[model samples]
Target: MPRADFPTPVKNLIAELKRLPGVGPRSAERMAVWLLQNKKAEPTALAEALVLAEEKIISCPACGFFATAEVCEICTDPKRDETLLCVVEQATDVLPLERSGAFKGRYHCLGGKLSPLDRVSPEDLLIPQLISRIEAISGEMEIILALGADVEGEATSNYLADLMRGKPVKITRIAQGLPAGGGLEHADELTLIRALQGRRDF
Candidate 1:
C-alpha cells in the first residue's frame, strides 16, 4: 500500500506542477488539490490546450517567435516598419513589448543571450539567421539590440556590435538608464553613464 493518503494520480499531478518555473512543492500541492477538488472541466480544458499547443506550435523560421505556421504574425505583418528591427532575448520578451505598443517595428528573438559559463555561444543563438534576414530586407535598417542589463547580455551585445561594425546596417543597442517612472536616486553609475550616452536632444 502507498504511504500517503492522496491517490497516485494526485501526487503525480503535484509533481508535474512543481516542474513549472517559480512553483514550489507546497504551491504545486495546493494547485493539484485545487484542480482535483474544483470543477473538473477547467483542468480538462487546460490539459487539452497544453497538449494541443505542444503538438502544433513551432518556432517561426524568420524571427524565432512561436507560431503554428512557418512564419510568425509579426514577421509577416506588412504594416510593421521593415527598416527597424528590435532584437530580444526570447520569444516571450516580444509579447510584452507588443503589449506596451512601444515599438512599431519588426523583431528578432535571439533565443537567448551569450553566457560563456552556461556554454551558450554566438552560434547557439539566431545570429546567422538574423544576418541573413537583414540581407534580405532592403534600405538602411537599424538593428536595435534590446538585450538585458546583465553581464551575459552585455557580452552578447558587445559581440553583436563588433560583428555588425562597418556593415551596411546601423547597429544600435537598447539604452539602459533610469526608467521613465523611476527616480534618479535609485539609478546606478552604469545606468547614469548609459543614460548620458543614449540621450537625445529634447
Candidate 2:
C-alpha cells in the first residue's frame, strides 16, 4: 500500500475544507497543507473567527439577513425607503446589491427560491414574514424581486406576482441584464445598475 501523504489531523482538515462550496478534494488538500505550513497562529485565528461568527451572528428577525442584533442594520435604517422592498433568495444576495449602490431600499430575504423538484414550496420560505412586512407598511410599497434568472426564479416570480395581485402594492421584477441561470452575486455593478433601472411591472 502507498504511504498516506497526510496525517490524521491534516486529513481531517482537508475533509472539513472540502465541505465548503466549490472546494474540490485537491483544493481542500492544498488548503490544508498551506494552513499547516503557514504559522500555526494563522489557522488558529481563522478557527477563532469562525467560532465567534457562529456564536454571535444570527439571522435578522425582520429581514432574514445576517445580524448581531434583533434586526439587520438595513432594516433598521430609517433613511432606507420603506416603500421600496427588494426580495432576494439567500442572505448573501443582499451584499451584491448593496455593493452595486443601485438601490436605496430595504430588503426581505426569502431564505431560498421555490423549486418543486427540490420540494421547496412557498411555505418553506419566509413568505409569511414577507406578507406581514407588506401589511405592516401598507402604504404605496413596491416589491422588487431580485432573484436568479433560472427557471425556478421565473416560476417563483410568476407565482409571487399572482399572489400579490389583490394587494395595493406594486410588484416589479429585476430586468434582464443578469445572465440566464445566474444569481445576483454573479452580476457586475453595471449589470445590476441596468437591471435595476430597467425593471418592469409584473
Candidate 3:
C-alpha cells in the first residue's frame, strides 16, 4: 500500500511532470496530489490515452505530419492541389491553416526551424524530401513558406528560397500578419486566413 503524504510512485510521477517545460516542482506536486485525491479514474484514463497515442501515432511519410499511417489523409486526398505546397515548421501548425479554409494546397512539415546554435541544420529538417517532392510534382507549382515570423524562421525561409532558385517554380512567403515571436499554433483562424491571403514574394 502507498502512503498518503508521499508514495514512491507518486513522487516519481511528480518529478517526471516537473521535467516538462513550463511545469515547476510545486505545480507537478500539486497535480499529483490532486490526481490522488480526486482524479484516480481520470489519471488511469489519461495514462491509457498516452500509451495508445505512443503506440498508434506516427510521422506521415509525405508531409511528416502526425498520423496513424505512413501517408497522412491530406497527402492522400485527391481534392487538394498537388502542385502547390505550403511549408510549415510542424504538424500542429497545420490545424489553424486548415481551419482558416484559405489554403487549397498540401503541406510540408520541416520538423523544425534552422538553429545552428542548437545544432539544427538543413539536413536536420526535411529539406531534401521537400526538394524531391517539388521535383516530382511538375508544372508551375507554388511553394508557400508559412513559417513563423522570427529570426530562425526567417533564416530557414531564406535558405529554402535560395535552394529553390532556378527550379522554374514560384516561391512565396506567408504575410507578416502574425506578430513577431508569435507561433502559428496559437494564431486564430481569421488571422491565419488573412496572412495566407496577403502573402508576398519571398
Candidate 4:
C-alpha cells in the first residue's frame, strides 16, 4: 500500500509558507498544520490582511520607506532634521534605528547594496535620487551611512563616499565592531543607539 500524504491544499499552503525567509520546509508544514488545526488561528483574517497590505502599501517616493500615501510620515514630519540624512540598505533597516530614538534625521533607503558578484550595481539602487536630494539642499548637510557591517556594505559605503567626494556634504558611516549579529534587523535598540552615537567620518 502507498503511504498517505498531506492533502493537496495543505501541501500548497506549506509550499507558500516555505517561500518566506527563514522558514524551512518542516517549519512551513508545522505552521500550515497549526493554522488549520489551532482554534485561535484566523486564516481568513490573515489572508485578508496580506491582500490589504499588498494592495494599499507602497514605497514612499521621497524616501524608500513603506507608505500608504504619496510620501512616508518621516519625510513629511517637520520636526525631523532636514540637514541630516541617514542612508540604509533597505526599508526594514529604518525601523530599528527609529526604535532606538537616537536618530532624528531624515532617511534614504538605497534599496540594496553594491554587489558585483550578485550583479547589483549602483544603477540598481536609489543613488540618483539620493544625489538629487543632496543637491536640493542649500546649506551644509551630513549623510550618515547606516548600512550593514558586511563586505558588500563596506564596498557600497566606500563607493558612495567617493561618488560624493566633491559634494557640499559630510559623509560619515556608523561605528562598526558592534554586535549587530548580521544586519540592522537583528540588532537591538541599545546597539543601534551606540552605533549612531559613535559614527565617524567615512
Q: Please, what is the TM-score per model?
A: 0.91, 0.85, 0.84, 0.88
TM-score of candidate 1 against the unseen true structure:
0.91
Clashes (N, CA, C under 3 Å) per candidate = 0, 0, 0, 0
The per-prediction CA RMSD against the true structure, in angstroms, equals: 2.0, 5.6, 6.2, 5.5
Clashes of 1: 0
- For candidate 3, lDDT tens digit of each residue in 80-185? 9988899999999999999989998899999999998999999899999999999997688999999987789989999999999999689998766677899999
Name the lDDT value of residue 195 in candidate 3.
85
Candidate 2 versus truth, CA RMSD in Å, comes to 5.6
Best by TM-score: 1
Q: Residue 102's C-alpha lDDT in candidate 4? A: 99
lDDT of each: 0.90, 0.90, 0.90, 0.94
Write model 4 residue lDDT over 139-163, tens digit each, in one string: 9999999998778988999999999
- After superposing candidate 1 on the true structure, give the runs of residues whose Cα lies further than 4 Å from its correct spot: 1-3
Ranking of candidates on TM-score, top first: 1, 4, 2, 3
Q: Which ranges of candidate 2 are over 4 A from the true structure? A: 178-202
The predicted structure with the larger lDDT, 2 or 4, is 4
**Where does the lowest 10-residue lDDT sum fall in candidate 3?**
32-41
- For candidate 4, the lDDT comes to 0.94
- Report how far off residue 133 is in candidate 4 (Å): 0.6
